[model samples]
Target: MIKSGISQIGGKYRLKNILIDNTPYHEYFLSLFCGSCVYELNKKKANHYECFNDKNPEIANYFIVIKKFFKEFEERRKKGPYTIISRYLYDLLNAGILTPDDMIEQAIQFHYKIKLSFASQLKFRGLIPETTSKKQFITQAKKDFKEAAKNRNRTEGHFKNSLGKTTRPISNNDCGILTPLNPKLEKRLKYVIIEALDFRDLYNRFYRSYYIKKGLTKEVFIYADEPYPGTEKYYGNLFKPEDHQDLIEICLNSPFNIMLSTGGECGIYLDALGDAGWFIKEVYTRYSTNANNQNLTKEYICMNYDIGKVHKMVMDNQPNIMNYVEG
Candidate 1:
C-alpha cells in the first residue's frame, strides 16, 4: 500500500492494524469520511470494490490530482511519484496566468493551505495555526489541549492565539509526503472510487444505483467512523447527540452490515447501537500521558457488532491497539 504519512485522527493509534484485519471486504466497501486513512484499507489487495468519500470538494479533487500527477511524473521519472514539482506551470498558476479550473496546481495549493493548520483536527481541536515551525506550533497548540485533558471539565475549542512568527512560508513541503505508488497499488487506484458528496446522498446513491446495478453476490459493509460523540467541540460541529441519533437510525435501516466506532464517552451512540441489536465492544487505547507523567488518558473504541464471532477477531488481530498511543 502507498501509505500516507499524515498523522490523522484515528492514525494516532494502532486501530488500522486491527481494522484492516477484522473489517469485512464486501462487494463494495466505502470509507465515508476518509482522509489519508484510505491507504490503510488499500494495503491489502482488494477482493472487491473500494471507495473513499468526503464532503469537501477540495479533498476529493486532491485525490484526483494526486492520481494524475503521479501518473504523469512516473512517465518521465525513473523511480516514481514522490515529490510534486514546482515548474513553469506552477509559476503560471501563481501569476494568475491560468485559473484553478480543474488544474493540478490548484489541487496542490488547496492541500498546502490545509497543512498550514496546526493539527490534524484543524481549527476545531488545535488552538493555534502553523504560522511558525512545526515544533513551535505544536508547543502553543498543546496549551489548551493539555488543559482540557487535565481537568476533564472544561471544553477546549479552537486555539487562535500564537506569539511566534512563521519561520518560513508554507510550500509543497508543508503538505509533506507525496506517497510513492507501487504498480499494484497504482492499478488498484484505477478501480478505487473517490467521491465528493453528502454522506446521505452517498448512502442513497449506493443503494439506488450501484447496489441495484451490480450483479455481484456478496454482502455490503459500512464502517461509519463518525466524530466521536462527546468530542464535538474538538472534531467539529457535526455529530452532536441529535446527529448521533440520526446516524444510528440511518445505519439501522440500511441493508448493509454496519460497524460504528466512537468514544465510550459518547453515551448516546453506545446506548442507541447497543439497544438496536448491535453488539457493543470496547477497546482500550491510551490517548496521552497525564501532567504527572503517567499515561492516564484512556480513549475507548466502542464498536457495534455480534460479539460472539467478532470478539475473537478483535483480540487476535488488534492486540497492540491497547498497548500504545502517539504521545
Candidate 2:
C-alpha cells in the first residue's frame, strides 16, 4: 500500500479497496480530480497507463514536482518549516511571494500546509492539536513558532522536549513536514501522467482524443471522485451543480467505461445515474476528519458497466468492455 504523503479533505485513502473492487478491467486509467491521488497511488500499475489530475493549482503542482523532481523535494523538506510557522510560509506562497518559476519551493510549502493545517484542510482556520482545548493548542503553537524561528531542524527536538516522558511515539502525521519520503510512492508515481486541467477539458484531452477517437474506448477507464454535493466549500466551491449534470451526461452517452464515487448523501447522483441505466453499488467506508473524528458511511459507486459481468467476461478471455467493442 502506497501512502499519498499529504492529507486532503475528501480523499479516498480509506476507500481504496472498495473502489478497486468496483473498477473494471482497463489498460488506461484516469483519476480526474485526483485529490491526494489515494486511488492512483495504491492501484496496480503494471500493464496500465495511469494519469492523475487535479484542477487545484497547489495540489497539481505537488504531483508535478514530486513525479519529476522528487529528489529535490525530499532535499528541501529537510530544511523546510516543520512547525506552526508553516502557516506563515503557506500564506506567503498564496500571496505570490514565491515566484511561479520556483515550483518545487511552492510544492514544499503546499505539502506543509496540507499536513499541518487543521484537519489536513488547505483552507483551515486553526492548527491541528492532539489536545481539545483552545488554550493548550495556542500555547503549543507559540512554542512551535519560536522553535521554528530559532532553528528549523530544532523543531524535532522541540517536539521531543514537549513530549517529556510521554509514551506516545512521534508520528509524521503529528509532525507535518517531518514526514519521511517513501521510495515506493515515488516509484509508483514515476510513470503517471500529471495534468492540471478542468474535468471537462481533461475528459476531452485523453478520454476522447486518445481512446474514444482511436476506437479504444473499452480499453480505457475514467474514475471521477469529485467533491461531494454538500462538501463543495472545502474544495473552494468550484464544482457547481451544473458540473455534476455535465458529468452525468458525459457518462450516460459515452461508449467508454466511467465510474464515479460519492458519499451517497446526494440525491442527484441516485436519481440521475440510476435512471440512466448505470449500476450503482453502496459500499461501506469509514471517513476520518482527524484522529478523533471518524464516521462510517456508505459510498455510492456508479458505473456504466456491471462489475460482475465485466469480471466474468475478463475471466473468459472473450471480447467485451475489457478488450473488445460491440459491433
Candidate 3:
C-alpha cells in the first residue's frame, strides 16, 4: 500500500482495516477532513471516484505539489545539500518572513516543519530531540552510557544491567528518512481531487457536482474524521463546538451514507447522534508514544445506516441509497 509521509495526531491510519471492513457499498467516496490522508492512502480503492478534502491550505498544496510538480521537486531535493532547517527558519515561515516564491519550496518547508517538530504536529511547539547535531548527540550519548553502565553493574537481581541496553543515541539523523518526497506517494495521488474549503462548503459542492448533477444513483459514502472535540488546539485549523454541532446536523440530514469518527468520551456528540437515530460503534485503540504512557482509549464511529445491512447491499448488487427524513 502507498503511504503518506505526513504525520498527524489522532490520524486514522491504524484503524484503516477496521473502517474498511465496516464500510458499506459505495461508488463514490469523499473524505471530508483528510488530514494526512493516511487512511485514504493505505486503503484499497477499486473502480471508485475518490475525493480528499481538507480545510488547511498547506495540506492541500502539499498533495497538489506531489501530484503535479513531483519531478521538479525530486530533482531540486537531490541537487541541494541536505541541511536541517533551524528553529529560526520555522519562526520566519510562521511570520511570513521567509515565504517561498513557489509552491515546491513551500511544500519543502512545510514537510520540514512537520518532520522535525515535536510529535510531527503542524503547530511549532518545539524541535524534536533528533534535531540535535550528530556529533554533539553521539558525544553526549557516550557519557550517559558510561554512567548508566556503572550504575547497572552496581545494581542487583532481575533489573540489573537493564540501563544502557540501547547502544544507539536518542537523537540521530533519522529525520531525513521521513521526508514526504516518495515517488510512490506521487503516483498514488495522481488522480485524486484535492480541495481546500470549509467542510460545509465541500459537502454541499461535492453533493451537487458529483452526486446530484452527475445523476449518480448508486450509494455515495462520506467518511468524516474530523478533529475530535477538546483536541482542536492540536490542529492548525480549528473545529469549534458549534462546528461539531453543525456537522452532526448536516450528517444527520444528508442523503449520503455517513460514517463519522470522534472521541468515544465526547458526550455532546454521542448524545446528539444517538438522539438523531445514528448507530454508534465503539472500538479500542492505543498510542505507543507520548501521553505519559496512558495509551489505551476508545473511539466511536457514528454511522447513518446499519452495518448489518451492508452485506445485503453487496449481495443484492443493487443501489441501496439512504432516504433521509425529518424526525
Where model 2 places Cα greater than 4 Å from the true spot, the runs are 46-48, 82-101, 123-174, 289-292, 312-327
**Model 1 pairs in collision:** 127-159
Give the CA lDDT, 0 to 100, for residue 302 in model 1. 37
Supply every candidate's count of residue pairs whose N, Cα or C atoms clash at under 3 angstroms: 1, 0, 0
Ten residues in a row with the worst lDDT in model 3? 311-320
Best by TM-score: 2
**What tens digits encode model 1's per-residue C-alpha lDDT throughout 1-327?**
445323344442446655555555455676677766543344454446667786666567766655556565333332323234444433454457766544455554544334333344432211233343455646755664555444443238633323223222332342442434455434555667878776777877777655567643235666677766555665444335566666777777776666666663677776776677676655666543211222324343334455345422232333554466742
Which lDDT value does model 1 have at 264?
A: 38
For model 1, the local distance difference test gives 0.53
- What are the runs in model 1 whose C-alpha is more than 4 Å off? 5-7, 10-13, 38-40, 43-46, 72-102, 114-116, 121-185, 210-218, 233-241, 286-304, 307-327
Candidate 1 backbone clash number: 1
Q: Give the TM-score of candidate 2.
A: 0.77
Score residue 136 of candidate 1 by CA lDDT. 60
After superposition on all C-alphas, the RMSD of every candidate to the true structure, in Å, is: 13.1, 9.6, 9.3
lDDT of 2 by residue, 32-64 (tens): 889888887876662567888888888888888
